[model samples]
Target: MAGHSKWANIQHRKGRQDEKRGKVWTRIIREITVAARQGGADVTANPRLRLAIDKAKAANMPADRIKYNVDKASGNLEGVNYEEIRYEGYGIGGAAIIVDTMTDNRVRTVAEVRHAFSKYGGNLGTEGSVAFQFKHCGQLVFAPGTSEDKVMEVALESGAEDVVSDDDGAIEVITSPTDFEAVKNALEAAGLVADMAEVTMRAENTIAIAGEDALRMQKLLDVIEDLDDVQNVYHNAELAE
Candidate 1:
């Protein structure tokens, strides 16, 4: 809509996805494989793997390719091992940033991540420097004009923690990470399709940035997001609309 909802960010992200389909697929594959390796290949029994598979499907990845990676990670075939890492930092306007990565080469990944931050007007901080500013949860955002009462009724009944409507008319439903899939399914069954839905590290507060600072911050986020080893980038900067 016209405000700072997850849907707005997702629309921006979707616009960027087409130009980086290959890179996006690469990241999704890594996520699927890692999830499978950590929690078996059965989607029904493995929530993380199920979520990864959903992402792969959303990206239009071939089912066979997805299955292959899952098998490889689950020991049916050979695969490269990966380790998950989190990097914290401060971006323009003193806003906090968190980068989540999964890589087979930790040294190379860290160097690349550090270089992006340093070159983009940001400072890479030590572990735990910025993570505390975020809360990890599931978020679903509906576009403006949706029925707030209906969303609230359905969401609360389905285990959502909160249903909030912004000034712009967008409605956001928040839920625990473990209840994400169930809530999403419930919403779908009730014919309430969300414009954006994901499990993410949400910032507790936002720092407004505008003019030159906003531009620099957007560039910093873009470069960091474009990094091959970077999986997810979370920040608390609310760029001027």
Candidate 2:
């Protein structure tokens, strides 16, 4: 869990840098559109939509853009009918990788993803090939000032599975999928604003890769994440300390 936390912190910091370049807004828009399409446009009623909106707000995305995307998705305003897709594979040093994407064309996304793997010294695998090594959990990250004990108490009372440390100035609360919204709301009510919250696939075990392999693994992640269709990239590469 400490390793997971550390990696999350790194990603969070990287995300802040990416935000300055406007890439984060693009990613958030895609995520919000998908969430709206799947769960309706009402943030109060759609938990996933609410999470997406929160992310947009955190990234300083314009309210008009957020509303426009939600409306476009829920109103089906004649655009790409984006679909959620997951790609499983191995990274440098045999570290398992899982990439989440939103694309209108599966064929193109698959080719692009596979090319990334191959070019980075790895190969793509079938649907369930590497997913079995991971577990799906709802993770909620708290702001730096949030009290750990208070957050933990709220999480536990709301049926959270675990609360752990993160390398970022935050804490992560893991909850069952069904309990995600409830737990998030509980923590928020207790004055803990979540830095990031999402249901993600987490690797059950990680493989330590060092030196050149570590650099290759990071490069593979960067390539995958740079893909326009990619939403999230998960892997079992033990993050270098």
Candidate 3:
């Protein structure tokens, strides 16, 4: 994490997401289906499902499509059953990578993921091989030029675990997953809007990857992310901008 720029990283991620907009609905549907199947169809009672629905709305997905997927997954209608899987690996410069997938065919998912890593000179590691490098939590990032003092005061007072403010990086508020919504709501009420927020596998530290290694690393990440079953990818590479 020594040379990692959180703001640049977040912006880069958003740009990548825009390029993958064609597949956004597919991924959200899978997320919605799995969440509902595992935790009933009631969004009010199922936090996971609620978050999935929120993502769908953010993506401008139709309400009926979202509801149908929920009903289908909850057994009110027929649907494919999905199983969650996590794949750990190492990218360029020994940077740790973690992939989260929901799939009906584990064999196919694993093959595709492994092939991507091998193609890019990386290797798929054992489960937990790289998981220890990340912390599972919620993060809210405010853009630069925002008042850091106000953000710190409101975030910490509203259950955020920590607030990291820096001129060269994102003003990040970290929280326990359960405390995430409360802290976000508090920030909003205080007129502090986060540019990005999510529950994620945040890297504890990062490795600098520049020049050719950075290009290879980005290509590797893009390939893995474009896989049909992959929902999210986390890594510790601080790539050159």
Residue 120 lDDT in candidate 1: 89
What TM-score goes with each of the models? 0.95, 0.87, 0.95
For model 1, what is the error of residue 202's alpha carbon versus the real structure, in angstroms, after optimal superposition? 0.6
Predicted candidate 2 versus true structure: per-residue lDDT over 1-241, tens digit per residue: 4534454534654664565457677778888888888889888889888888888887778888888899998975755688889999998878999999989899999999999999989899999999999889998877666788888888998899998866555778898887988898888888787766778886777787879888888888888888989888888787564
What ranges in model 3 sit over 4 Å off? 1-4, 167-169
What clash count goes with each model? 0, 0, 1
Cα misplacement distance, residue 156 of candidate 3 (Å): 1.0
Clashing residue pairs for model 3? 1-206
Which residues of candidate 1, in runs, are more than 4 Å off? 1-7
lDDT (10s digit) by residue, model 1, range 27-114: 9999998999999998999999998998888889999999999999999999999999999999997899999999889999999989
- Residue 15 C-alpha lDDT in model 3: 82
Measured by TM-score, how close is model 2 to the native structure? 0.87
